[model samples]
Target chain A: MTHHTASAEELEALARHARWLVLSTVADAGAGHIGGPLSQMDLLLALYFNHLRIDPSDPHRDDRDRFVLSKGHTAIGLYTVLALRGYFDPAELATFDHGDSRLQGHPDMRMLPGIDASTGSLGQGLSVAVGMALGARLQQRDFHTWVLLGDGEIEEGMVWEAAYAASRYGLDNVTAIVDRNGLQQYGWPAGASDRFDRRDPWAGKDVGAIFRGFGWDVIDIDGHDHAEIDRALETACGARGSAGRPTVILAETVKGKGVSFTEGTYRWHNGIATADQLAAARAELGQPETVGVAR
Target chain B: MIAQRQVWGETLVELGASDDRIVVVDGDLANSTKADLFAAAHPERFVEVGIAEQNMVGIAFGLSTLGYRPWLSTFGVFLTHRALDPIRMLVSQTGAAVRIAGAYSGLLNGRSGKTHQDVADLAIMRTMPGMTVLAPADEHEMRAAVRWAADHDGPLYLRIARDAVAPVFDIDTTWEDWAPRMLRDGGDITVVSTGVQTSRCVDAVRLLADRGIDARHIHVPMLKPLDEDRLAGLLGERVVTVEEHTMIGGLGGLVAEIVAARRSTQTVTRLGLADGWSESGPDAFLLDKYGLSASRIADRIVGVHSRPVGTPGV
Candidate 1:
């Protein structure tokens, strides 16, 4: 099946629309994460709209490329992207996090289409992605596997364990995108104690160097820039399965992007958005003031 | 007596010959777990994932999604204790068809001490949703269980012992309906057992017969999805459970729960280790120390049998 590759300009517009959907989805649920979803909005938009070779109608096709959201707390972002990409009806976004809803608090592959794996527990999706890459090689298929991880999620040792295995197996068909958003759920607040002086846990640590040390081809880029995201995805796909090395793209971003009050703040990492906050966010994204839920 | 792990390795190699989807993912204990035989036969499909058990399970889950039957071979403790989160999330929650062959199960791996031994694998694996837990009685049953798991479509956990023991069932014995098999039929008392300890229970039953105490022997291979109706029919007035695992949640706990749910007046005497760790020693010494030897098991049954009716045995 042929796929339409959206241009950089189109992807930018989609990202803006996705940001509004994410904030409104969380607002409708009264319980969801916002900061991480906004942080990884452009990255997911660029991949779903331009790179991933997937058919929304045939989500489980054998040869389709696989994508796993490692940082599954931000599933609202992925659900919005999947709905916009036509994997399911966009009106179903209102039922997210509700009882009997297919859109669970975390991604459940069994309950929803287009979810390659059920992932909520951090530090495990990369390993599953590595296995998918190996399966592609064993089955002699050309499909690629991509996994998105959070910066704080990297603190899990299992992530590094999967990193070593992907490198050891020479799985070039798999690519890892780390959302280096520089904020976790619990960051240092203003003027509490000297011990809590830093904003994030990895304030001064070099994430790209760490992935490079794990024998991956590291590509650093601005996560919110559609052009940079498009370029990094191109490079990652170009080196697929032939370079004999897995590639990791470290995309630097804010905790919450595209919103003046929420950007770069951990307070919005996971919380209910009041009507006032939702209206402000929608107004900033150039969306209509009707913010009960996204259509 | 042939080692169960050896039978597992040989059976895996045979399965790989006919099914190209059979892949072995070992966690650096291929030789100890006897997965090396499959590696030697199908080197291309063998994945040496080093000593990472969690990642090994995650990889198997990934492969299972793409129609590949991946078997994860590792020590039982690491599989149950260290990699439980991955198994719960990646395999059980999703119902992935990943085979987890847990080697060196039970207290029989005495040389490795309590740290390496796994005495509660059944308690853990059986409780997980959508997991098929099995513990074969001997080499013959191990072969059958391995072949069954190869064709079954779901998450499965096979508990393999470290040492070889006597076979309780014949080579042609097949698991029918995933039920508990009756090795001996008697009327005085019923003795239920699972895993490698069932063989000892068989010998203990013989000894009980010699002592004029007729004891029925029921061997359970499949712990989860147990044939509860069949097992309830086989239970007698007095029941005793024996296993190499802990006393709390192994065969003993299972039998006790079944008996309690029925509200039957029959007494259940649980025989296994207490709520603590055992020292490193030979299999015989450890089994004897834990009241699991054939003679010791026979003695314990005799004590429970001699008790008056409606009186529980501690």
Candidate 2:
């Protein structure tokens, strides 16, 4: 699980591709989830390009590590990574949200390649990942299953059900990362609730402690910090083999991290970028007129 | 005579041995539903979720997520009524492959009263997206359906009767594959029946033949994705649909959609339970009162065909 460094040129190019992919897809369709996709773009780029053991051309490679984007509304990041990894032609990204397109609003395993599970209804993906991990263990395959979850999605009761089951089974091969960006659809997690309240809802909840209480090896890290992310993943790999204990990484992230206007705003979670907004965002991301190797 | 309810439990136990991934879940009625065999053999896999049918469904969804093929058994009344939403969201929306066995269905809960006898399970499950409905004709077909479901990866809802009706199918016959089978043949009228009600329809056909009435009976085990083409071919100009389930969303409703679209000169007579809760009594008494007996069915067919040579009677 050592971090294999992608050249600076490759990193920049992948980041650029992921950023433009989400922006262009949103622009092509009349709407899309903006903030979550923008925030998770770097994590997806790093995984697909540098770490994930997968062959884009051979999407169904048996030994490939499986990845599920449980928070499927932010599919732009994952889809772009799949395209760059060669799962499909990059040109198909433009057709996102169009009629009869494989790249729909959410990930569909039947339609798209390299997607382990088709997910949109939150709190179910983690359970499926646990299944995949169990399948691997039963067959003695060395592949791991990773699931990306959104912070707001934790509100679903089924998430806790899966968490409890995963710990009970001691599914070490499965790892879950919650993009701990406080805002949800309506407003902040606290503002959107009457039943529950918290200051920094993500931190105050003690998601790590809950996992530990359920017998999981918990790791908390800054999602944007690549070095820390790499270290946590490596530790998770080592922890996976030691007896029975799964790992849950609580990744603290900023919604719309790079963009100034949309950053940390609940309204921007599913912001429809105006023509002006699109142009400004594209300029800030350093997207060129013609797409090439993303120099 | 073997009940459809018993076959479901027996087949699940047999399949569980071969397929270790298969798990049986019961909502505190393992003995009633006959899933105790599975519980004894595969203790690790068998989960008794108490009497919480709603929570049982949610847990089944959770198990299906972990690569376990969970077959949940419960009374039709509770399984369909109490857990409809979770089953719809988890199995239909997320595309989990969970099998739900609804026993004691459609007036089969003898002496269990209105609250226990379920005539709505078929209507409820038939309306779900990505849900495959299997209403086996007899114990043989019911066992086969359970075995087939274990190998198949998708959501399934099966309705079973509690009464020990005589078997309509041969013990050697393989109807468990979900493929519709042709039971009897004739050119005059086609009779499509499902579940335990199919045996009564067969008996009705025998009675009709005594009075020189010719009819074809096509037994459909799979309800959803209703064999539209197979049904169209068999149902000529005169057809009758029968079920122990309510006529609204049962086999009658399914056949009506296909027949209406084709605009075939065929007239369909639907024989099923009338829409109402029933009083507590033996299932035999309930069947007689509801006009679900073979004698009543034969009389109805005789009355319809006697109308006119070319036209069908309403």
Candidate 3:
């Protein structure tokens, strides 16, 4: 299979497009995640556009590298990226959170095409990815499985359990990317406020050290940087099975990257966007000044 | 006669010998759950998920998608309560083919006290949409249920007791069908039971026969897809349900729901543990205390039948 490495500039453009779509989609839907999706769009763009071995025409292709969005509330981001990747029509982003739309509040694999696993309840995707990686070994397929998790989502004990098992079985074909955005459902980010005693809302835990302690090959990268995201993912993909441990890329990200008003705050996790705020976000992303643009 | 979980472990060896796809995942209670037998026999296919029941279920659900027939075993309480959310989302929602052995259930685990005693296993399992809930009466039925679950796709929860039971049906009999099996027939009253409670019903039936009560006996191994039609046919306006579970949700609750929906007029009497926590005691002492023993079951049936107004005599 031939693969092309999208230039950092191209991937950055895609990420901006995804970010623009995330803002407009959530604003249109009136109920969708904003902060985590915005922070993680670059990584999503890097993996989906530049990396994931998937065909939009035949989304269920057997040899495709699988992806699981463990932090499922951010389906708006994944759905937009999947659309941009040609899994569905780019126009469908406008239908997000609509009563009849397949783009549910959580990522449902059964309802949507190209979704490897249905995950909404936190800290479960890594275990499923472990199984996918194990499946690769059992079936003798050389495909890798990637899972995107939130730093706060790691607070779940099941995450640790999966981390332990993945290492115990030496599932190197699995890669976990933690969107270390420093804010969770609670908005007070590490340095955003001192209410949490100078610690991130995710309990001041070391994301890189945690994965390394769980016997994974850990990588720290600037999540908003497409070049760094591309390099880290490529390194993890190349080191699969040869690394002797599951790889976890802890990408440090702002709570909201593109939009200054929503950036690095907990409120935007599911914060409703006013009309003016939505227009400001559009101006930031350089989209046409149209309210809910058709397509 | 043998312990149902003992038979479950042995059957895992039998199935594991023939089927390479069969894998057993345990939650550190393999010996108590009898999954250690599978672990020892086929270490390559067995997984010990430490003391984490939640991870055991998640790992097992993941393994199922990879063409593996996974049987996750632990005490009924943990599998039903500790990992229920995942079991619902991952296994039930996805409709994965995973066999769940909820072992050390009912009064059998009385020595472990209330925390381990599984009275609500059936009520919880029966509520799941795609869950095929089964509670075998004896070792033969347990073997057949395990085999059936292996072939039957989707999620299956097999609830089993820890104690060895007296065999009601021979192993040679066709133990495949899930419909409630009629062990004895009469028009006076129907006595439906499951697990070791079925053995108690058998003894009670013998005692009732001597008293000319002519009670019909039915063994309900399959609790969820219950044989409501057949049970209504033999119930004859009066039915007595026996189970070593909580009176709220186990066999008693299932029967009440089936009878209420199918035969609303039929008078159903339920006997099980009270709605209070139970302390540690001898297995026999606890059974009689809760009126689940053979003699008590017979006495309750006689007392109910002899009463002229047809009111329940607890």
Give candidate 1 regions above 4 Å deviation: A2-4, A187-198, A290-295
Q: Single out the weakest 10-residue window by summed lDDT for candidate 3 chain A.
A: A189-198
lDDT of each: 0.89, 0.76, 0.82
Residues B1-314 of candidate 2: C-alpha lDDT, one tens digit per residue:
77777777777777877787887777779888888878887787776656666556656765575578888878878878876766766677666888888888887686888888778787888889888988887887777777777777889888888877778877866653455667899877778888888889999999998999888888888888666787688776787888887878788888887888987777887888777767788766877888788988888778777766556423
- TM-scores for every candidate against the unseen true structure: 0.97, 0.80, 0.94
Q: After superposition, how far is residue B208 of candidate 1 from its true place, in Å?
A: 1.1
Query: CAPRI verdict on model 2?
Result: incorrect
Stretches of model 3 off by over 4 angstroms after superposition: A187-199, A289-295, B309-314
Chain B TM-score for the candidates in order: 0.98, 0.95, 0.95
> Using DockQ as the measure, which candidate wins?
1
Error of 2 at B53 (Å): 8.1
Pairs that collide, model 2: B144-B176
- Which 10-residue span in candidate 1 chain B carries the lowest summed lDDT? B169-178
Of 2 and 3, which scores higher on DockQ? 3
The local lDDT score (0 to 100) that residue B197 gets in candidate 3 is 83
Q: Write the per-residue lDDT of candidate 1 for residues A59-169, one digit (tens) a residue.
A: 999888899999999999999999999999888999999889999999999999999999999999999999999989988899999999998899999999999999998
lDDT of model 1 at residue A11?
A: 79
